[model samples]
Target chain A: SQQGEEDPQALSIQEGENATMNCSYKTSINNLQWYRQNSGRGLVHLILIRSNEREKHSGRLRVTLDTSKKSSSLLITASRAADTASYFCATDEAGYSTLTFGKGTMLLVSP
Target chain B: GAGVSQSPSNKVTEKGKDVELRCDPISGHTALYWYRQRLGQGLEFLIYFQGNSAPDKSGLPSDRFSAERTGESVSTLTIQRTQQEDSAVYLCASSHRAASSYEQYFGPGTRLTVT
Candidate 1:
């Protein structure tokens, strides 16, 4: 079974707008990481937020984790058509090496 | 540095036939993993290999599915008697070390189709 579930299965936005996707998980985790997948391509690692961290940033991407709620969100600012892709959240259990992934959110940025 | 790589970008086989998928991890990475993804679903863990430790095969769905890694560098996943339901993208990922908090680098997966 999937340990995480993403909200708003799909999102569409104009190139310059900001897009946000949320994910909720069911178990305690050592960390949570986000990945992006272009259609038919490999997954690209995004940002990773440890259980002790609340927020992280990289370029135009921002991620937040709220352990109390077992939820996390990814924010893509000033989106571009090239930024369009499926985003997924994967949770790493405290004592395990395998990552459990969520159903992912598809973001489409229209130019 | 080059990232993870996998062979035979795509594969097609008739039901009941066997197929082999290969993965080459990034240099120096000690942790390797395999996962499966259906059309619009989340990734499903399949197997894991970390250094010299015994591999964790708990995620493999059946005895017909097995994977082997050669000293942390290359790994292969083989399925016997493929079934239509087994068709999906097989992804490989590698990390510098085996830990719950390490980030992983993924390879372009092999799309397998069982006819």
Candidate 2:
């Protein structure tokens, strides 16, 4: 069973536009991490936000975590056609080492 | 200096045949993990290993699946008498430490197909 669920299974936007994806989980977590995967390739870690933190930023990516709402969002600014990929959120529950991942949101950035 | 690496980028075998998938973690990385992803689905946790200590095999789906890591470097996942349901992309990942939270570096997974 997957612990996290991402909304908007697919999204499309023009290059240079911003894209946002949301994820919701059912259990309490110690930290949440986001990853990007190109077609038929392994995942690349984007950013990680701890439960105590409200927001985190890395490169052109911004992530927000709201423990109260059991949700998180990832924002990619100045998107490029190269940014077309699937995004996933993995959650590490409190007292657990294994991270559970969401189904993922597929983003298509057009040139 | 390289990231995690898995061998046999692709594998195809008939049903009831046993198969082995190998993964070599980055040098000095103590934590290694394996995941399975079916088409149109998210990655599913399969197993976790920290150094040569006991591995967390709770996520394995059945008794036919087993894994072994030697000297904290290369790891092997073996599926015995595989079934068609066992077909999936098997991914390997490694992390520096298991301090509760750390980013896992993934390898290009081995695509397994059981006929």
* DockQ of all candidate complexes: 0.86, 0.74
* Predicted structure with the largest lDDT when compared to the true one: 1
Best model number under DockQ: 1
- Proportion of the native interface contacts kept in model 2: 0.62
Per-residue CA lDDT of model 1 for A23-107, tens digit only, reads 9999999999999999856899899999999999999999999999999999999999999999999998789888999989999
Q: Chain A TM-score, candidate 1? A: 0.98
Q: Please estimate how well model 2 matches the true structure, expressed as its whole-model Cα lDDT.
A: 0.93
TM-score of each predicted structure versus truth: 0.98, 0.98
**Per-residue lDDT value at B105 in model 1:** 93
Pick the TM-score winner.
1
What are the clashing pairs of model 1? none
Q: Rate the local accuracy (lDDT) of all candidates.
A: 0.93, 0.93
